[model samples]
Target: MKSRFLIALALSALSFSAFAHVGEAHDHGGFLTGFVHPITGLDHLAAMLAVGVWSAMTTRRLWIAPLSFAALLLGGALLAQSGIAFPAIEPMIAASMLVVGLLLAAQVKLPEAAGAVLVGAFALFHGAAHGQELADGSALAGMVAGTALLHTAGIAIGLGFRRANQWLPRLAGAAVALMGLNMGWSLIAG
Candidate 1:
């Protein structure tokens, strides 16, 4: 238990450090840039993986939540490209990460549609961020594919964690939740 907690703490610190330096949000373009974008932001990584973790923890339809997230994420990207601004996107995205962490920690259960809606909403903010990067054509394709890969990774982690001892999952969830809180606070404080 002590070792697990220490590992979680180290991971949380690493995640926080990863997001501390942001040169520009629009620095990503092309296939490689788009592919790497999701991992670049700590909040985004947490949110995406949390969705997978939540879905795995639940007994509902797993694929629906992720698919809905992807489709609506595309819509959000298009909306952003159309010159529409969702002013609270940054904070909201941060909030999504925070909420995802909370849900994971709590192991909350909901019906399929509700879960879909939850993840779908978060996906919009994520997609909007991608759109802000102005990625097009191959770049957009790469991002979508990359996102799917991230979701896959999340699912794998969720499954693997479930198979592990109980405390590890909770520890990981708590770590993610704390990171989300820190991320939100830093953004709001700044």
Candidate 2:
């Protein structure tokens, strides 16, 4: 636990530098852009990765969880483009990370339906944020595709690690929760 916390702290410090490189030239803008957006934002990265880890821990249907998130996230993005309002979205996004992380860390085994509902709700908020960024004319397709890819990568990593190390998921969850706390503080302070 202590080692995990230390690693998270180290990664948190590195996040700022990670975002700074977003404007630089990269490979394919499509997936890379989407991938960068989620990882660059502390809150989004934590929440999305937590979803992956939690899904791996709780369900054997690995693809279903991420696909569900992607579909609903696209729906949310469409809503945002249409100028729909979901108040307190940023805070909700942060809270999702905290909630999902804690749930995974505690190994909460929720029913399938309830888990789906929870993940869907959080995915909507995340999608809205992505849509808003896209709507603002910030590399729309690339960013979306990138984020989706990153999400897949996170899920793959979670699934792979979970098979070997039982403690990995909890460690990931705790790290995610710490990131959420940091994001929450930043939002409140800012």
Candidate 3:
């Protein structure tokens, strides 16, 4: 079972290459383009889900977790759009995945405020990446909605499998952390 899960996570991480970039071929400002950006990136998707899962596992205030992530994610996106430079944005993004995954796996239960701040910080990286792709307000809106939906999915997964088997989330978190190491290595190696 563990082997199978690892295989699946590997396969999913392989899709990171398809992540949308600024000035890509289809780089038009629109809803669908922005909507697909978050989901397309394995790092982003995993981190988002991990945050949601961690929130659900640790707190009954499930809604608060996603809300905090999305709000701050939007803020980061806006900051990115303003042509502001955030050094090591890429590394931060990958690290967010690793940390969030670890948190989920560890099942650490932080205070709600601390949890919000944690996710908010992670969101900045993700939002910056998002800003690069979305050049228009509509696109930004779509991306925000899409991110919310992803959070919902993560929350569902976290809540869904939590009671069935606590190990499931931990396993998923470990896989995400491995993916983060891979991403970080690629950044350094490249």
Model 3 residue 109 CA deviation in Å:
0.7
Tens digit of lDDT per residue, candidate 3, span 1-190? 9768766865676445322243233434788877877887777888888888888888988878789889988888789778776677778877887788788889988888888888898788788778876778888888888899899998898889777677788888887787777777777877
lDDT of 1 by residue, 60-158 (tens): 567777777777777777787777776677766767777777777787788889989988998887788777774575667667777777777877888
State the lDDT of candidate 2 residue by residue for 49-73, as single tens digits. Answer: 6777677677777656666676777
Best by lDDT: 3
Ranking by TM-score: 3, 1, 2
Every model: Cα RMSD to truth: 2.7, 5.1, 2.6
Clashes in predicted model 3: 0
User: Which stretches of candidate 1 lie above 4 Å from their native place?
Assistant: 1-11, 14-27
Model 2 residue runs over 4 Å out of place are 1-32, 136-144
TM values, all candidates: 0.86, 0.76, 0.88
Cα-lDDT of candidate 1: 0.72
The list of candidate 3 runs beyond 4 A from truth reads 1-27
lDDT of candidate 3 at residue 115, scale 0 to 100: 88
